[model samples]
Target: MDIVISIASKIAESLVTPIGREFGYLIYYDTNMKDLKDELKQLFEMKDRVQESVKAAKRNGEVINYDVQSWQTSVDKLIQKVLHFEEEVSMKRRCLYRWNISRKATKITQDVLYLQKEGTFNNVAHPAPPPMIWSTFKEGFKDFKSRMTHVNRVTEVLKNEEVRMIGICGMGGCG
Candidate 1:
């Protein structure tokens, strides 16, 4: 008797859980869309504010972060989704379709919220990294006495009119 009761309870709980969740989605479909619309609006505002910062960074010749660029692309794609959803809503939509649309709106709303949190860019853009060639040569270059003598000889060789071609060989690095 005890084993039978336990099995019954488990089966009942599993059925009840899914039914309850589906019912919630169906019942709150309109509410979900409204909340999603409001969140999307706020997301747009946040995106605009961030865009201003990106613009400022560009003007100052700072390189934008990869994450920030990715976020912008995501927002752009979301705008299209919202537009498509809006058109669908404006048309004659069936009650059965409500759940699907509601689910989509809920997902997009959550995405917008996630994006808002990620939009916080304390370091939106950073100073661009120096070119590798510069770092490899100029940055680590030292004016050693021996190196300077080589430099003088190279310059004299270059100044000679008969010298059509020249090559720099030695340390081949900052040395």
Candidate 2:
């Protein structure tokens, strides 16, 4: 009986630690994409639920069943998916930033051409203008904040358990 209890305790520890570590990692991961972040947050909540269920099962000295294992496997797969999505988004954003910089450089060149055509600069020795890359990065941050705010509002509404149904009272043709 003592040996059985010891083995059960060991099993419980093994099961709980990996789930806890995964949960910790997921919570700590920084994601800029609002939808993906929200999905990770939801997964974190699910991890809590699974942890509780595991605890209850352990308290009863019951072996973890196949269904529980399957659920954990699914959660693990979801975490992997989220990580992959994050990497993909990050790469895309980097590409977008580079593209924006190139576009801005072209626009600046066009402005220079227009100024030359208009004879705006009388002096040929003029100081070079400061880079606009910082402004572009700031715009990206603003965009991210706007998206995060919208996602947060929607998440809050959906998470409110009391609000079972939502109605959109807007012009039908406008939508």
Candidate 3:
């Protein structure tokens, strides 16, 4: 029973982790895109309102009612802040996507290592399982190390890219 449970747990974990990671990536992408779209709609609506207010104030010989102008300015600033936040979230989502890829790669590499370690090649004597076992372990470790390094590199690249994108968007007021 203990052995059964242990095997069952490992199997379950192997199955669940990838699916969970994938689901998380999908959810982040979906939610961030939705938020971005909503923010865009809000920006447009704010612009339209600003135009209408200016037109009304102009027709009445006042470009803005002082009190209303203050409120509009505050709302505009808030909207700009929200757009910035959305951009941040989008950047995070991209990072999450990359992280997901790294995680899956690591998982596969580990699974191969696990199977090889469990004597999966014990029966084959023609090619000498000793070299196969040694090489597999060595290669698996190398892959693991490389994957970790790539994950860090990917994260840094993403951070820099996000900063550049934010700067560009801020300058254009198009976020």
Best by lDDT: 1
Best by TM-score: 1
> What TM-scores do the predictions have?
0.70, 0.32, 0.30
Q: In candidate 1, where is summed lDDT lowest over 10 consecutive residues?
A: 132-141
* lDDT head-to-head 1 vs 3, winner: 1
Cα lDDT tens digits, model 1, 1-175, are 9999999999999999888877777899989988997998899998999899999999988999999999999889889888998888777478878877787778888888988888877778999877666355646467788778888999999999999999886657544
Candidate RMSDs in order: 9.9, 33.9, 34.2
Candidate 2 lDDT over residue span 55-139, tens digit each: 6666755566555565566666656655664465456545445444333333333433332243322221223356566432433
What candidate 2 gets wrong by more than 4 Å, as runs, is: 1-32, 94-175
Q: Which lDDT tens digits does candidate 3 get at residues 1-175? A: 9999999999999999878967665555545445445545554565565557566556655434454455456556555655565455556546555455444334433433332233222111122124233332433333366456656765776778445532212222111
Which residue runs does candidate 3 get wrong by more than 4 Å?
A: 1-29, 86-91, 94-175
Error at 97, model 2, angstroms: 11
**Deviation from truth (RMSD, Å), model 1:** 9.9
Summing lDDT over every window of 10 consecutive residues in candidate 3, give the lowest-scoring window.
119-128
Which lDDT values do the candidates have, in the order given?
Answer: 0.85, 0.52, 0.50
> What is the clash tally of candidate 2?
0
> How many collisions between residues are there in candidate 3?
1
